[model samples]
Target: MIELRNVGLKYGDKEILKNVSLTVRDNTIKAILGPSGVGKSTILKLMLGLIKPNKGQVIVDGTDITNMKEASLYSIRRKMGMVFQGNALFDSLTISQNLGFFLRENMKLPEEEIERRVEEQIQFAGLEGYEDQLPESLSGGMRRRVAIGRALIFKPHMILFDEPTAGLDPVSSKKILSLISSLRHNNNLGAVIVTHIIDDVFNVADCVAVLYQGEIIFDDVTEKLHNAQHPFIRSILSDKILEL
Candidate 1:
């Protein structure tokens, strides 16, 4: 499980998150929903120990990582995989190389094992024949799938997604959402998806935490979101997509 206890952050004189608290259990999908520039992605950085909060604690699994050293945090961070908004694939490398790159760089596993893992991710991501192609040749949705496969190659306990469906056609968005849902049911993996799209939340998240003005205004099961009385929540419910 991951828990943020009254977390707060600041950039120079500007505050980003304030008294924000949330918990994500295993084998479930949780979404951090908010408008653009509201520091939604900052929360993922905190969970990974990439940044420290000015106040409060970030607990991952059972360890309190708020003040942990970078070296110590390495082991902790490996427990979760992160898929950035941009697919972040190496444009020069083939799809298979991209999937196996991290294992080759970070682990001392044998060549055979690396190949096995890479093949597994290719099949999982449904990219069997495209393994030899560069990311640039694939469509936006295919690139996103490759990114997700790369993340899952680590076999992390949980996955963190930053705007998983941000720039895709409606069919592509639906496919990505289906892929995320399958992670929990088929792989027994938990996920934290940070998105502004309301339909994306309803499609995949089991629970959600609504962030606004650096504070979490609502946190509960996805169904309860419709019952939230906050004006921002009401406005978002009506808008469906938070372009703000």
Candidate 2:
């Protein structure tokens, strides 16, 4: 489980997040909704320990990880994977090499073991034929899949996704959404998805947290989100339906 307690972040008085609190249970997908520049990405960075929050604590599985040393944080990150907005695959690396590089370099595993793990991740993301291909050669959706493949290669217990379906066509977005949902259900990897896509909440989330401005406006079970009577949520949901 992941817990944020009274978490706040600031950048020289320009606050990015304020008094934020949220809890994400294990073996479930937590769908986060918010507009761009509203600290959604910042929250992920905080959880990853990339940046420190000015106040409060970040707890994962009962550990108050707010002030953990870098060594411990590095080990903790082994159980976490983050997928960025642009897929973030290294342009010069082959798909298989991209996924296998970390395992080979970081774990210093044997060549055969690396090969086996890479093959498994390739099959896991259904990118069997594209192992030798570069990111530039694949479509946008395929690039994201490769990114997902790399994340899965580590067998993370916690997965953080940033805008998994931003700017894609509806069909592609839906397919990616299904992949995320399937991962948690099939692999028991906890997922935290930060996206603006309303359809995504319904399709992929077990719980949803809404952030407005610099604060967490609502956090609840997916089925119970609409019961909060949040004016902003209602507006967003209404607008999303109209777009459909």
Model 1 segments beyond 4 Å from truth? none
Root-mean-square deviation of every model: 1.0, 1.9
Query: What would the per-residue lDDT of candidate 2 be over residues 138-158, giving only the tens digit for each residue?
Result: 988888888888888888898
TM-score of 1: 0.97
Off by over 4 Å in 2: 241-244
Q: What is the C-alpha lDDT profile of model 1 across 148-172, one tens digit per residue?
A: 9999998899999999999999998
| Poorest lDDT segment (10 consecutive residues) of candidate 2 | 235-244
Candidate 2: residue 216 Cα off by (Å): 1.2
lDDT of each: 0.95, 0.85
**Each prediction's TM-score against the native?**
0.97, 0.94
| Candidate that scores best on TM-score | 1
Alpha-carbon shift of residue 122 in model 2 (angstroms) = 1.4
